[model samples]
Target: MSKIQHFAFLLVEEFSHLAFSCAVEPLRIANLVSGRTLYDWSFGSENGATATCSNGSVTLVHYGFDAIPKCQQLFALSGIHMRNHVSKPLLAALRRERARGTRIGALCSGAWVLAEAGFLKGMQAAIHWEYHDSFMEGFPEVNLVRSVFVADEKHMTASGGTATADLMLHLIERDHGYDLAVAVADQMVYNAVRNATAEQKVSLQSRNGMRNRHLARAIQMMHDHVSDPISPALIAEDIGISTRQLERLFGKYLNTSPKKYSMEMRLERARNLLIQTESSVTDVALSCGFDSPGHFSRVYKAAFNVTPMLQRGRID
Candidate 1:
């Protein structure tokens, strides 16, 4: 029998419950399927206080930052507004764990905390797609990729949600064997498992159920040109579809016009940059391809109900 490997998780305030459950459940299933104590885990918190999840659920911890127990691996689990939980003491604790040669990783937005601690500098990592722009802008040195998870990197990163389960399964496969990973996955009844290389974004086909080649091509073009947005007419012409047909496709599937979709995409990136990076509002506006800052602000306010200026102070 292989030795029991202990894993510890440090939960931040407002951690995503789904990510946390996904991270731990795989190990539990691995043990159940293997019929052995192949894995063990415990939770930790910054303080001795209970950690609250994003969904308002509370988790009790076996340890605190003051005394992070020795373990084979440790993961930092966080979610939205991850920066608010980052602090010098937390970074120092992670450093101590690393100094002791403990393998460390993150689930979901926890990579943000890892990057903030300088642990993931110069390494490839996966963060949830929503934060990709902000993470890139904030941590320029960190090689962020659009994937469900990154397992082989020095520090593993799961983009969060079910991706955490995929990462845990990958780790089980690496440590034990493919059979054990598959068994664990089967026990969990988790089909449709995705590997690290899978793109994090939902494909247009899967999201909209629109298999129209023209629509796919048009959407791809929009994604490719967010920073230098092109006109809907140009997109329609290039994709060999009439502008009217293009609008109908979007309206039928996405319930929005092409112009609205494109604008929403750009605004989403702009919001991410505003909250995740130090870029000025004008720079963010330009990067998102808004010619006029006033126009960008109006659109942004209308979409988010908050002005870019107000969002600027949100970066941690």
Candidate 2:
């Protein structure tokens, strides 16, 4: 028989209850169907005892950071405000655990903690789409992918919500078999088992809730040419709108000016590239549409308040 895989889920404040349930339920059903405990799991928290999830539900944690159990895998589960919750002690504990050869993983914004703990250096990771911008600003060295999840060697990360279920199912398949993983999914009525290449969030059509073809094309142009971005005036011209009109449209709809939004979008892409790619800082700057590395550095430092070299060191 294969050895059981013990998983320790480290819960954080405002954790994603849905992701937690999605991760654990599959393991539970797997054992129930196979009539064996192929997966053993427990919960832990920094403070010990209980943690309130984003939905206002409370989960009782069985262990604290100081008393973490011997487990094959440790996944930190978190949701909103992950940056605010990361303390020096928590990062130190994670670093200590990692030094002991314990495999580390994260779900949702939990990647933020892993990044802060200096564990995601030169590692490909995934975070929820909503926080992708903030995460890039916070940890520029870690390679951030748009995929639903990334599993490399002993490390695993998922872009929370239902993606957590897919990640756990992948683990189950690795431990048990594909048939067992499928059975667990069937039991859970989970139709979508997103692969590693699958994106974390829905398409722009769903996100924008708009059917305007010109706006869609403009947005696509911006996304496609993130590194060499076109000017807002150019985008307006292509979409047959005056620059002033375009600014008004974006301000009315997106609550921001077109130029500012485009700059933000480019910076966001730059942040992701910095974390996910090994390109030189100059290369990263050029790729992100910044003609001068000095300018890029100034803006990047203003946004993240850290030099790119230091950020890279944190991830490496």
Candidate 3:
């Protein structure tokens, strides 16, 4: 038998319990199915003994930041409020681990932590989609992708939730063999296992159950230009369709017009920015294409029944 490989997880405050389970269970199943000591794992936290997840559940740890044992790999796991929890000690621990030549990775918003430690400056990484906006704004040097996970990089990353399982299964296949990985996945009854190249979410076309290429192109254009939105006529013209046809497409499928849908998209981005970043209300409004904060506030209240300031305030 090959030597047993050890994995250590550094659980940050407010880590995702779902991601934690997905990351560790596959290894356990692999050992059970293989009937050998193929892998071993342990947990670490900022403090020595315990870490808490976002769902308010506590997890015991085998080590702390100051004394993470030697391991083949280490993964940092985090979730909401990830930025706030990135302390100096955690950064120091990650840097120390990397200096010791341990392969490092992240799960969920934990990429933000690794980025903070300067380990992912030019690495292609994945973080949960909800964090895409603020993460891009914060870590422009990191090549963030929309995939469920990125495994080929020196530092692997999973976008969190079940994507962590996809990554773990992939590692199992790499370390052992495809048959054992399949057996482990079967043991878990996870039929729709995705690869690293698979995107985290279904495409808009799939989500809305439509295959309209023109509609997809238009929506992509809108998403790509949320900060500096263009008119519906321009979108239609760019997509080689008439503005009337564009309006008709939206009306038939989304039950809204292009203008309304675009406005809603911008408002949604504005709301995310308010909750996820430290941008002022005026800054968030401008970032989402509004010129005047007062106009933005009125439209925001009309749409969500609360002002942008209040939205940010609610998070505290």
- lDDT string for model 3 (1-316, tens) is 3889999999999999999999999999998999998989999998889999999999999988999999998999999999899999999999998899999999999999989888888888999877775777788888887678989999999999999999999898888887888898889998667666555565675544246889888989999989899999999999999999999887655546889878877987787788778999989999999999999999988876678888764311
Better model by lDDT: candidate 1 vs candidate 2? 1
Q: Candidate 2: minimum summed lDDT over ten consecutive residues — where?
A: 307-316
lDDT of each: 0.84, 0.79, 0.86
Worst 10 residues of 1 by lDDT: 201-210
Clash totals for all candidate models: 0, 4, 0
Q: Give the alpha carbon lDDT tens digit for every residue of 1-316 in model 1.
A: 3989999999999999999999999898888888889999999888866899999999999878878888999999999889889977778889999999999999999999999889888898998876765787798898887668988888999999999988998889889987888788888887656656555667566643346788788889998999899998999999887999988887654445789778877877787788678999999999999988999999888865578998654211
| Candidate 2 per-residue lDDT over residues 1-316, each given as its tens digit | 4788888998888999989999899989999989998889999888888888999998888988888888898999999888778876667768888989999999988988988877887788898877765666677787777678887535789999999998988888877787888889889887557556555545767544235566666677788888888988899899898888777766543445667666767766666667667888899889888999999999877755566655553211
Clashing pairs in 1: none
Best-matching candidate per lDDT? 3
TM-scores of the candidates are 0.67, 0.67, 0.68
Name the runs in model 3 displaced over 4 angstroms.
202-217, 220-235, 238-316
Q: In model 3, what is the error at residue 5, expressed in angstroms?
A: 0.8
